[model samples]
Target: MDLSRQRCRLWKELVLVASLLALGICQASGQIDINPDSLIGVETYRTRLVLENVTSDSQQNGPMFTGRESVLKTGDLHIRGSQLNDTGNYTVRVDAINGTQRATGWLKIQELEIPGISVNATSVVEDIDSVAAICYTNDTNVMWYVNSAPVSSNNRMTISPDTKTLIIQRIERFDSPLQCSIEIIPEIFGRSELIQLTVAYGPYGMTLTSMPNHLSGVVSAEIGTPVEMKCTAYSRPESQYRWFHNGSLLSFSGENISLPSLTWDQMGSYRCVVGNSVTQLTFYQRLQVQVPWRPKPAQKRVFTVSGSYVVVLIVVTVLGGVVFCATLIYILFKHYSTRTNRLI
Candidate 1:
């Protein structure tokens, strides 16, 4: 009987522990659950609130908050045709059978206005003109981009205090297609149309080339041979060309000129003038066109024969003088020997 009483006491303690666990679980699950902590709202769009462990006695308090009935209790709050005025904090209180629970959420509505950009001039000369680009928007925060890269203030570029205007003291050709962008919401941005610039640049690096024959700025062509000349220069706008002969301008005006037949009259100084109307720059180059001097076939033969006869005559004279010197030496040695023998 004492053992049976001890077992009964243990059973009662187990029942009490199980009841306490049940109470703790009810308290924990009774807290309200909001599916999302924040939401982005747009006009004429629909949104629904998801709630857990809430009863029909629950009430939602916020701008434009509505509700519908569910099988278990009053269902989630439904917002139809949300607007900017409906953007605010929302609170829900539930009078559940277990206890009272509360939850709060946020709804943010975005402005759909886009930004614009304006420039003082549509075209400017590179390194010779200044430009002012302004971002037009209600928001003061702004950013600038050139060729799809971020722009920073330098010795020639500056940004306004509010960052709305960008001033370039000396614009370059690479700084084109400027764009201005602004952020309306986190990770949401609005950009303006691209502003393209027409930058006028130089006419430089003058060059003149000849077809068929050219040697160190001199054009050599046979008589009656056709010669073609081409001139080139680097410029933003294409360079204009003019040809001149012996300081007198020819009637031709282009990058290429042709001399149909080379003659003595064509053998003079030829000049090519390259100029740019936009940049107001000019370059000139001079090339001498000449027919090289060469002897006729008959004259060349006569000269070759004369040179050979002179060389042969010199060789024969040297050999004859050497023979005569040897003979004189032999005669002198014979006479000296005959005299010595007589004396002995």
Candidate 2:
């Protein structure tokens, strides 16, 4: 009886060991995870496993691939230094106790180079000069931008067949700081240096304003009063200004002018001529200036009453003088008569 019990215990221990070994062999053939893409000179790990006698079509006993063990007892295929020629499909196989399992993947290695841009001219005249710009890159994926916004073919602009060159028949001043970029993927990209464009524009929309505004195209002010005028126009390189009076050019040339004291000689039709040298464009504005004639000084005034009071005073003076003369004559006549009668 003792011998039989010992035999049964030995058999049970052997079966338990075999079952544990089978479970370990099944766990060793776990799923594989790999990086599909990598950059040149970068280290890449293709897979992680603990399977027995692992092999891959990408690895042919070369020094480029080295094997390492992870903390979880997982085997890893390590690429020491990736190269441009090492881009292709890869297949890995593992020999397990159950059967031969396989996992396949693709690896793409790329070499990135700096991008550049070239242009025919940096400065151009608006509506007269055309511009061409080209991007330099080995990549076929190209994109263009103007002022940080994407650009496309339009009536005034066109793109080349390969989308590497951009042409503008009539470049405007508002379009500047062009840029080009290569998009390898959503996460990988390269950009070129910004190229600025200088466009010379016009001298249009001319306006002349006075400090004391004019009424009905006429500037009226009193003699000896100061007047000021300012002229302005829209331009790229700053417009040149000239002043004219009565169809004759003045000695002064600027955007603003002041007449210290307005006079007859300084009054007439005033004009402001604005011109651009680069674009060879011109504009002008006109206004009439009039100085009113000054009036003369008045004579001194005397204190006097109304016409009716003057008439009353003259009549009263005449009556008083007549009464006094009549009284004196009467008294003299009476004296003469008394003397004569006494003598008789």
Candidate 3:
């Protein structure tokens, strides 16, 4: 009886060991799990596959696993090549002492497509209340750069809503050639093309004035007499005119002198100084005063009526006496002549 029991016990132990070995073989033969089946147009991407044993038996065995020469044991599989034709599907197989497992994946290579770009505006004006527009083509987003640095967020530099152009408003005189670029993707470090711009300075210095350098006039008792003085000057910065007399500035406030009052005090050398910030010029005119002449009592009148009457009386009396004598003599002569004639 003892011998028979020992044989049975030994046989049961051997069967248990065989069953465990079989289970271990099934576990090693399970499928290998790869997350993705294929990859297309990928550049420098990581590939990974999970080796899974579905059987419940836990046992270690030597397996001949096959994979691409570039594949890693734990981390992602890295694949790199210059052209698209260098891509191919990769299959990994694991073979144990009892069974085998397999996993497959594909990688497709592609070349980066960089878009063409161009800039329109070449020159810009500065220091004035003006805006400059820059146009671009065949780009995703327009980026504005000034002297190679990005422009500020201030309203002066802004991107248009359409994303096709950039506007710079109220540019300063000191601002230089504002550089600009278009970026397709920031991470990809992809750039289209380079462009340059030039900034220009000033249409400065303007001046203005009237004609006729000299002015003359006369004063009279007539009320509201109009006297006009011409104003004239020249300058580059656009001079403005202001009339002055006796160091006092004249106003165009009223009808006379274009001011409220034209009193005597307002009369003097009138000067008009024309100038701007850059240069100055001056003009001048003289004014004179006049009065009516009057006579004095000391100077006597020549030929009065009394002297004329006395001279006339004396001349009349002398002429009368001469006439009487002549008449008397004539009568006597006449009497004698008559007697003689009778005697003859």
Candidate 4:
């Protein structure tokens, strides 16, 4: 009798275990899921409530998420399109008759495809307003970036109504890298590669700042000394420098013109022409290079004075010559006379 009762209890226990197994049908899994914006589940809960991931509480709208894109179908979370700012951790929870089942996963968005990125003008003159830029693609919209920073619409830069084209008005001559990208879920969508811009401006701040007197706007070099002068300018797309003397071009290319030693023949009107090939704008700065060193005559003097001192030097020189000749003649005559008397 005891053995039959024990078998009966064992059979009841087996039945209870099977019932619990059926109730545990819904289980949570941590999987990396990719979606446009929302993630789905494995089992369908007709009346499902999102415990997380929505901007607003799902309870306020309805007992379940019935939004066309958010409907829980076949237990999958149907997330929808997203803005650039939408990103981060997202999850969903639903109550099953047996217990609560939730899928915990993160969201990631893929960037749109584009044929290419290009500007309306590859090279533009600086200070021009409203130059159109386009990101060539089937996509109706694209976000523009300058040097990796998002380009916002303003007076100088305006986005078109469709957002595919960007207009840059009042373009400065500063060269910058431009890119067109899309906004994704977690971060900025991958941008279309291959877009760079060049802005051409005049040779800016062109001046010869190396010569000793260059600060005074004059280029002066000392004769018989090494000469190095620089004609420098700040510009975009780099300015090509040309050095000229007496209206003739030098055979060198660079900001600096150097000579091992300067001479009087090298003294002339030295000019530096700074030109920007992109803009075809040129600027010129001219100054006379004067060598103040002069050759002195063989005459020696303790002090080199000018004006009335010249007369004093002349008088002293003549008096010294007269005294010297007289002294020599008297000495020669006395010697000759003394010798004649001795011979007689």
Candidate 5:
């Protein structure tokens, strides 16, 4: 009876060991986590273990070395230098004496955070060829985008031989907001901060504008009235203004100037020169000043009002003329009367 009891105890010990081994198999079916850019190894205690890196055939397209093939090895699978594409579920199978056991669980692949980026030249001439922008990271296969569109090898833009640099030949207006995105395709993509590019060009249509703008590039006003004029130009970088009068610098720096009064000397050639620092371009304009004709002064006139002196002079002249006329008439009448009476 004691021997039979010993046999029963041995059977119970063997069954307990088998139960523990089955529990370990169930635990292996659960999720297994790992980060990229490091080494990872998954092991199972079984007669034979097979691991299938089936990400390429499945929904995932992450970069992986094994592609879509399976491997049979001693109960352990080793992966070296993992990347973004190594993420997803790995098929685990165990071939035991009883039967074959299979399970699926996640193998997490954490991505490397995107880093800061820079451009060789933020601003380039409008017609300049060969504009380069580099994405700074140790990661491989960086993609570039312009205005939210994928950039590929073409006449307008091309990728470098190493695929680390993006070259844009003959920049265009839409080249602003250039970006670099790092991803393994289909999923797991991180974009760098946007880096804007400016196209430097001309300082065109230079003119002297005023409140009234007496004329194009000319400011005219009354000689004593205050007059103000502004120098204006267009360019990628704003142009600087300089004012000169008769070959003499009137202002060192300013966009606009005010004149208190105009004189004969100030009525000569007035020039306004504009310069663009980016394009190294300089242009100037000259304005002529003329004075209007002035009218001559008028002659002076005199007037008087006196009554007594005028009356006395008029009466004396009339009385003397009357007396002389009467005396001459009396002598002539006496002579004429005597001759006429004798004849009758």
Candidate 6:
């Protein structure tokens, strides 16, 4: 009788345990809830769902929820779906089985609006200051971006107060192609077609040369006497050539420059420098002037020898004549005297 009583107590305890397990299973399976029936202006909407335990007071463990490899939790579960063109309801189901119990939720989708913005100026003079206008299709608040950086009026940039346009006051740098983009915010989705700006700071090069190859002689020479120098130069920007004589500016006329009549002072190393606002180039040459030298006769020697030498020569000649005459006469007298003595 005692053994039968013990067996009956054991059976009652097993039945109670089985009933408690069944109740726990029902409590573990819960319901889910999501707010906002529909969503708008979003490419994809994330819907959060809350799961509440209806029967149980303690938490239960099971396999975590998933959607196409995306993890979903019990409470505050996020669901996402594709709505490329169609905007309508998207159903998200959460399958949980704890002794046969399951739950699901739903969300709605909508479309958003974007704005438009573009650049006006395409090409501009290089180095000098220029302006590019950023305009919006519907005259909305816009921002300016030059090569991907936001610019406000500083040393080299100026943005208009309205924010619809940007005026680049000075382009002190960058010689290559520059890109300007405009972004308009708010209701409209805006993007600018790239306005390629070509900054051209004109080509600059200069060449200097002498009209007639520079050498130590008369260049722009006269027929007989004075020597002159001519210098010429060529350049894209029409270079101005200044003739330098021993490092001093030599004045000239027209593009064909001419130095003053060459003198001993002007004869030295000469060079022609060609330059403009853009570039400077120089050509060098050596110059020398030649003049003949003739000596003058002595006036003092001509006057002193004129009378004295002539008188002295005449006197000597006259004296010799007189001496010869006297000699002849003496001879004749001697002969006559001798004859007289003989006759006596």
Candidate 2 runs further than 4 Å off: 1-111, 292-344
Instruction: Return the clash pairs for model 5, or none.
Output: 62-85, 63-85
Between candidates 2 and 6, which one is better according to TM-score? 2
Off by over 4 Å in 5: 1-107, 113-118, 136-142, 147-149, 153-156, 161-163, 170-174, 185-188, 196-201, 216-218, 292-344
Q: Pairs clashing in candidate 2?
A: 49-75
Q: Candidates' lDDT values, in order?
A: 0.71, 0.67, 0.44, 0.59, 0.59, 0.45
- Model 1, 123: alpha-carbon shift in Å? 1.9
What is the TM-score of each predicted model, taking all chains together? 0.59, 0.56, 0.32, 0.49, 0.47, 0.35
User: Which run of 10 residues does model 2 get worst, by summed lDDT?
Assistant: 6-15
Pick by lDDT: 3 or 5, better one: 5
The TM-score between candidate 5 and the true structure equals 0.47
Q: Write the per-residue lDDT of candidate 4 for residues 1-344, one digit (tens) a residue.
A: 12112111111111111122345343333332224334322112121224332221121223323243343323343444442222234444443334444344443333344446667776777886336777776666577887767878987888888787878887865435777876432343547775566677777887775546554555567778766677889877899988899999988889887767888888778788999887778998877777664688798769669978999989999999999999999999999999999999
| 10 residues in a row with least lDDT, candidate 3 | 6-15
- Model 3: per-residue lDDT, tens digit, 1-344? 12112111111111111223444333343455545665554333333333344333232222322222233333234343334443555554444455555566655554444434444455544443444545445555656655556665476766676565556666554444454555433344233344444444322332222121222333322223334444444333344556567667776421123313345554445555444443233434333322222466687669756877888988888888889889999999999999999999
Report the C-alpha lDDT of model 1 over 59-172, residue by residue, as the tens digit: 223232233212123335556665566565656554334555567666665554568899999778777899999999888888889878988888988989899999988888
Q: Residue by residue across 6-106, what tens digits does model 6's lDDT show?
A: 11111111111122254433234444333443334233444344445533222232242223113233333334652434233333333234443334333
* Higher-ranked by lDDT: 2 or 4: 2
Candidate 4 Cα misplacement greater than 4 A, ranges:
1-116, 135-142, 173-175, 184-190, 211-215, 219-222, 251-253, 293-344
Q: Which pairs in model 6 have colliding backbones? A: 114-188, 114-189, 115-188, 115-189, 115-190, 116-190
| Best model per TM-score | 1
Question: How do these models rank on TM-score, best leading?
Answer: 1, 2, 4, 5, 6, 3
- Report each candidate's C-alpha RMSD, comma-separated, in the order given: 15.5, 18.2, 25.1, 18.6, 17.9, 23.0
| lDDT comparison, 1 vs 6, better candidate | 1
lDDT of 2 by residue, 128-218 (tens): 8988989998777778888888899999889898989999888888678888888754555567899999899988778889967987767
